[model samples]
Target: MEKVLSKKRLQIPQVVAALKHRNFRLFWGGQCISLIGTWMQNVAQSWLVLELTRSAFWLGVVSTFQFLPMTLFSLYAGTLIDRFPKKKMLIFTQAGLMTLAFILAVDTWMHTVKLWHVLILAVLLGVMNTFDMPARQAFMIELVGEADLMNAIVLNSSIFNAARVVGPSVSGLVIAKLGIALCFLINAVSFLPVITGIWLIRLPKPVQPASRRCQEGIWQGIKAGLDFVRKTPGIFVPLALLAVINVFAFNFNVLVPLYAKNVFHAGAKTYGFLMGANGFGAIIGSVILAIRSAHGPKMRSLFIAAAGVSIFELLLVPAKSYTLAYLLLGITGLWVITFTTNCNSLLQVQSPPNMRGRVMSIYTLVFGGLVPLGSFLSGSMAHAWGAPAALGLGALISLAFTVALVIWRPSLLKQEISFKWQD
Candidate 1:
């Protein structure tokens, strides 16, 4: 009995294995708290935009303003991330984000919140995020090294989805009782734990300064990153697929709110619950990946997940009831995290350590930078037809793209990834 118990205790699940690293544990805990507030703000912001404008086009415009900086400057931001210490840069970005949240909260509280105020603040928030996203992605490797890199990435996604599960649901209740201002205020305060966690992290060794070649010039660095992606088939293929999927299939921010109002004839609480349902599915998906972290990322799984997202999204077209929509969105959420998490791991594992930041910047660029265009497309489509039609069209486009990729490169499904780059 004693021997059996000892053996069982030694078998820690792969899902939580990344937390064994002290720095990663701190970072994970902090993010878990912070992301919930972020989601609350996200839910409130979308609903707030609708309350102010009641136009899907205007909602897209606000989203466009928020992500425009990333579209324009993410490549340049990547160079900066490569040239600096990620932790310090992250601290600065977090503080900037916190300040913006506070400003928005104050404006909303004072009833001086105009659409323009939200737009301008969103632009500032985008500026902060262009730097923060890639830095954060690149920093994961440093926290746990290559041995636990996949575990760390999946763990990060798990917490993010977990927050998605908690944040919007709670935000619905908060928004119903308090107001949208409180959500922003809570988000502003939530930054403290993450900032403190990053500050407390002690890397095993000092990170090296950027190579002279990397510091040559911002334009040159951007060119190099792009050139590298163009040449690497493994990295390039996933990115291309992600770009298509991101532009069409991932406009839930714009569509979900509209669905709640225009389709379901429901209000804020229903919208929050819908968003929460999607997050719940995402949490389940992340848990599945966490359990299978030992397998790392696979090309076949990536394609399948991409296809799954489109298929599930397409099913939403026939959903007439809130329960059916919620169920479909949950399933869609599952496929989304699986596809994105695999793409992220594939990019990081494939790139040389020196180029990881730039590679991830490209990832951030497509994943987020393109949100403006996607949001605009979805919003315009929703305005012209309806939320369901817009969503159905995007899903159709995404499914077509996935099919085209497989036809174009039948070999991609069988390609085995090599983790040859030294950490």
Candidate 2:
């Protein structure tokens, strides 16, 4: 028994081996602090929008304004990341986001914040995110190297989920006591640590372009990335499924708040608790993936996780009791981490180093870009039919996708296709 216990203890470090690297440790530590504040703002913003507009339709509108830029310019942003120094680009984006948060804080403090002010700020942040998401996602492998990419990605999810748990819980207290403006102010200040960490870190020399052909121009770069995804089944299939899921299943930002306010007749505290519950489940899922990094190809894991998410979401629609609702949300969170983390890590592994930025940009475009549409649908559905129905609609769409994938899984998994492209 003592030997078995010792063996278990020995395995713990292997699970977090990515943290042994200096650059990644620094980056992860900074992001852990930053993401907590980001989640806080997410909750506070949703509540604030509800407070300001008193309409779920406007909630969707706000979300659409925030994410619209990703749909418009993420491909160009991806090309920019591929050309520029990623860390520096991240600094600029983070700074821009910080400035927006501060503007929100001041506007709220002065009691001058209106629906237009909020929408404009959301649009600005969305613009920053178009550049930020792809750069950050692609930067992770560079920090820890490809050998530990799975562990690093899992750890990253764990931190984000940990923040998800902590942030809303804290925001609930802050909103209840200090008021909502403080949440935005706190989030703005939180960017400092990450900015400082990025500035201090040293990266290895970048690989020179092996062929001038790939670097011909911005349009060529965009076309190259698109063509790669178009032809690569391993990458394209998962992305297609992810995009479908994004459009219907991943409208939590809209659904959760509506359910708290309209369905449950709860306050900000209850909403925060619900979001925290989801985060708690997500952390559990991330831990499982961290421990077993070699869980086979990502597509298989993604499909399984998607099914779990859909089932839990459907269960959530009928959950009348607060406890039962929390339980269902938590279960959905667990599968959310598993599905997204697998999709991200798998896509990273499948792409060449040169194309990683563009591929992830496409990913950001599909995922972030579609949220506006989903949010609009979710908000509109909630306004018309109530929150439960909106939630059910998303759950049903997710389940339909899962059913379709299961039907096609055998042939999809067996087919071996080359990614080579000829123009």
Q: List the candidates' TM-scores in order.
A: 0.97, 0.95
Consecutive 10-residue window with the lowest summed lDDT within model 2: 414-423
Give the Cα-based TM-score of candidate 2 against the true structure.
Answer: 0.95
> Residue 318 lDDT in model 2?
82
Per-residue C-alpha lDDT of model 1 across residues 1-423, encoded as one tens digit per residue: 999988656545666889989999889889989999899999999988998998999999999999999999999999888888899999999999999999989999999999999999999999999999999999998999888899999999988998888999999889999999999999999999999999999986455655654557888888999999999989999999999999999999999998889889998899999999889999999989988888889999999999999999999987889999999999999999999999999999998877888999999999999999999999999999999899999999999999998998899999998786795
Pairs with steric clashes in candidate 1: none
What TM-score does prediction 1 earn?
0.97
Task: Give the distance in Å from residue 200's predicted Cα in candidate 1 to where it truly belongs.
Answer: 0.3
How does each model score on lDDT? 0.92, 0.87
Error of 2 at 290 (Å): 0.5
Cα lDDT of model 2 overall?
A: 0.87
lDDT of 2 at 146: 67
The candidate that wins on lDDT is 1
